[model samples]
Target: MADVPTHLALGVEYDGSRFHGWQSQPDHRSVQQTLEDALGRIAAAPVRVAASGRTDAGVHATGQVVSFTSAAERPDDAWLRGGNSLLPAGVAVRWVARVDPSFHARFSATARRYLYVIQEQPQRPALAGNYVTWSRQRLDDEAMHRAAQVLVGEQDFSSFRGAGCQARTPMRCIHQILVRRFESLVVIDVTANAFLLHMVRNIAGVLLDVGAAQRPAEWVGEVLARRDRKAASKTAPAGGLYLVEVHYGDCFQPPPPMAPLPLSGIRDLW
Candidate 1:
């Protein structure tokens, strides 16, 4: 008799510096491909994984969620420990649990959170080179926060979306955006119902312009109204971006804390 397939969910954390992205590509190494391979080895069969979001190349994630179905019947802890043993140093399965058949990692997600870390310094970061973006120009965290508020609520994000973005619609609701400074690091944390390709990076670019005084805080609203990508600043670097969390309605527990550093109480809007 054939056993019923078991649906499983996982929490993953990875350094994206060494892979192409989270999705599988033809010849390039990707986070998804790596995880699928590790899982396949454990299941003794081919495995496919679907993530809560698809992060681009060089983007890291501390709380990525994924779902898959298998008949291996391995214990939850075994999936966590065994998958880590097979994965590379840059990636690991942080948690694993059995989920209901309806619990999908991507579709079941209600919101996604991203964190962009920037180092404000004349010289580049040495210890955190591949993990952060550096800017020589001074940034006004206050101005950035003010500018980002224009993005709250549902709106067409064509100005910030990637050219190659394939989402059926350009409208997305940004639940919150907070800009703060922690020592030398400036963190931009955003929560959205969903994101278009390169959306957050483009928003960060525009906020950088506002912080540098090249553009007024009101410019963000104008760009949103224009619905043209060229009106916004160039997309920021991928290294600074991190997929911080994915929210599900009732299926999974909260992810482990990867809390931000101490902040300067810059500003944040719910």
Candidate 2:
């Protein structure tokens, strides 16, 4: 008798420095390809994985989520142990749990949060060289924060989009935008319903210009109003960006309830 398939959601973390990107590509190493390969080895057959979102090359994720189905009945540990055993170094399965059949990892996500980190010290970060951007110049955190405020709420972000982006619409709702300084580090945190390709990097680049006093805070509003890609600053390096979290609806109990805390008071960025 054939067994019913069980749906499972898996939380993943990976160092994106080595892979081409999260999506599968011919003749190239990718996060999806590596994950599928691991799953296939464990199940002794082909396995497909749907991710919460696709990340570009050199973009890392700490809380990336994926979901898959299996006809064989196996405990959650089976997924962790089996998948990790086949996965290469730099990629890991944090946890796996049963999820509703209707749950679509990408579509069901309510919000996505990303953090961009910049080390402003003169010397490069020896340990974090591949994880963060190193900038020797002093940054004006106040100016950057002031510029970020202009991007809050629903807006047409065509100016910040990449030329190769395939999203149907450039409109996206930004729930939060924050810029803070911790000694020599500058952190930019953004939460949104969705994001366009290169959106965060482009926004960070523009904000970096503002922080360096190369561009005024009003330039952000001007760029948004223009809806022209050329009006925005250049896209920043991918190493600085990290997918920190993804939020689902209240019905899912996989992630424990988050206690209410002062939103702007949280200082640890990424």
| Highest-scoring model, lDDT | 1
Q: Pick the candidate with the highest TM-score.
A: 1
Error of 1 at 59 (Å): 0.4
Span of 10 residues, lowest total lDDT, candidate 2: 256-265
Query: Model 2: per-residue lDDT, tens digit, 1-270?
Result: 788988889888888888898999999999999998887777767789999889999998877889888776777787898889889998888888888899978988999888888878778778777777778799999999998999999999999999899999999999999998877778888999999999999999999999989999998899889998999998999988888788987846445322111112444543
Candidate 2's displacement at residue 215, Å, is 0.7
Model 1, residue 80: distance off in Å is: 0.4
Candidate 1 lDDT, tens digit per residue, 159-244?
99999999999999999999988777888999999999999899989998998899999999999999999999999999888887
> How far is 130's C-alpha from truth in model 2 (Å)?
1.4
What is the total number of backbone clashes in candidate 1? Answer: 0
Off by over 4 Å in 2: 253-270
